[model samples]
Target: MAEQLALRGDEKLLDLGCGNGFIIEELLPHMPAGSFVGLDVAPGILQSARKRLDGADIQAEWVEGSADELGRFQDSSFDRAIALYMMHYVDDIDQALAEAARVLRPGGLFILGTDHPDSLGEMHEVHFKALRQMNDVPSALFKSSPKNRISLTNGQEQLQRHFRNVRTHAWKDELLFPSTGAFLDFYQSHNHCSASSIPGLDLGEGFFEELRCRVGHQVNQIITQKGHFKVTKHTGLIICD
Candidate 1:
């Protein structure tokens, strides 16, 4: 991401949906003479980001605002803009992109980090199989990754609406889970095995318990057959200018 930004150490950068400032922290070293504005809708998250960069000797500001509304920043104020892994949560994806384009300088680059629709195919495969085996499951629960809203597959077209040039840099890697517990932890952290994605499902703890057990069983079987259960990550960056 930093390489795509091509920071000259003095450019003003804007990070839309900058969560906890982890990306900002990593990129700050490249922008020693630069300033950053981290914007997000959650005040709690903004506070967390401020705390995370408390001692860093960098010019950084945290703003509590939505990505679609960049009224706080003036036009052509940023040399680089980024919406990393958080564009899927934007209420209005087009508006957010427009706002980003408006705020960026003429030659500014916007890097959007997102995953392919089938990024974690193994995880989804095991999860759907478990859901199918279970009784009385909500159909809405059988949905694709939320990132599909702005994924590598469809992001280029969306970005082309605003930027003259849109390039996709895709790469793949596999995550090997040594045990069922490790895989379960990864699964639960990602929307609780997709249970949390469906609105108003009102499923009880028992449902999640059973779902986890089933998914864990599948992962365990894979681990026993192979040395570990593998989850392929097909993710990429959509760089626009």
Candidate 2:
């Protein structure tokens, strides 16, 4: 992702939904003379980002705002803009993209990092299977990944509306969890073993506990048989200009 940005050591950059400044910390070194603006809706997240890059010798601004509304920035105010792994949460994808385009200079790049709908197929397979066995699983639990709204599969068509050229760079990789505990930690931390799909399901704490137990049993079986449980990641970047 840092390489795709093609930073020139001096460029005004905007990071939409810049969580914890992870991406900024990595790419800031390459742009010593450049300035950055990190915008997010969460004040707590913005604070974390500020602390993460506290002592850095660079120009950085943190704003609490939504991606769909960029009135804080003037037109052509940025040389580069990025929306990484957070577009699905935007209330309006088109509005956010349009705002990104409005802020970037002519010929500037907008790098969108997102996943394939089936990116974590292995995890979802086990997760859904376990949900199916449960007595009263919410039907919404089986719905597709939220990323499907603007994933590598359909990002080009959406980006084409605002950019003259849209290019997709894709890659695949796998994560091998050697233990059921390790995989369970990952599963629980992310999407709560798919329980997050139905935000309003109102299932109590006991419900998640049982769901985790079932999912863990299946993952343990896979690890026992294959020495490791594998998770495939299908992800890509849609670079626009």
Candidate 3:
């Protein structure tokens, strides 16, 4: 939303938790002369991000650090800041928002986009059962955890407490696979509910084969809906002053 919210031609923009530098790459055309900085905690992810935009030819900087504590920048140094899929992982939401406000100029805007609490249950439809079955464990193993949707209510409240204005929006989308087996395989690489985030997520040996069989049996009953599965999402904007 930085481009939509009037990120100027000369303003310095900061992207918090900018996974793989995707936004910086996409915003290159609009910010040919503007400075873009991407911040994330994962060093490996940042390395891959550098490769993603290797030949973009636009000026940008990628740093491995916490957005909640911009170690290198002075107060009120940035013209705009955006936090995408970030607040949930932060230990201190208010402090993060305060840091955003600290780095942003008085009139500058700080935007935040995070997964809605409602999306947590919906995401499970695609991968949770397999997450349990793959390990040959009981369903109760990980029935209660906030991997994809943590800090549901507190996050929103904290944003409101820190930002001057708050606005909301809702969205939903579907993930398609050729078959249920295809989906199980994809989850190996793409599942958001990792073991560390979810308690008792121990899928023992022969995970792939077992998960595939279970998913196929259930998927065959519902073919009219096509190969895709729907995912509901909600997001809001915290306009920092």
Instruction: Count clashes in each candidate, considering only residues at least 3 apart in sequence or on different chains.
Output: 0, 0, 2
Candidate 1 similarity to native, TM-score: 0.96
Model 3 stretches astray by more than 4 angstroms: 120-122, 126-154, 175-178, 196-205, 224-228, 235-237
- Summing lDDT over every window of 10 consecutive residues in candidate 1, give the lowest-scoring window: 191-200
Local distance difference test, each candidate: 0.90, 0.91, 0.66
TM-score of every candidate relative to the true structure: 0.96, 0.96, 0.78
lDDT of 3 by residue, 1-241 (tens): 6544575577788988888998777777677678878889899998988899888776678988886677588888888888876766766666778888788887888777766555534445645665655544555545544424434344556666766765554355555555655655555554434532344565554654565566555554443466554434455554555
Model 2 residue 30 lDDT?
89
Clash count (model 1, backbone only): 0
Give Cα distance to truth, residue 202, candidate 2, Å: 3.1
For candidate 1, write residues 1-241 as lDDT tens digits: 7887877899999999998999999998899999999998889988999999999999998988999989878999999999998999898999999999999999999999999988888898999999999999887887666788999989999989999999999999999999999999999999775686566778888999999999999999999999899999999999999
- Residue ranges of candidate 2 with Cα displaced over 4 Å: none
lDDT-best of 2 and 3: 2
Question: Per-residue alpha-carbon lDDT of model 2 for 184-219, expressed as tens digits?
Answer: 899987867457646567888887888889999999
For every candidate structure, what is the RMSD over all alpha carbons to the true structure, in angstroms? 1.3, 1.3, 3.6
RMSD of 2: 1.3
Give residue 100's error in model 1 in angstroms. 0.7
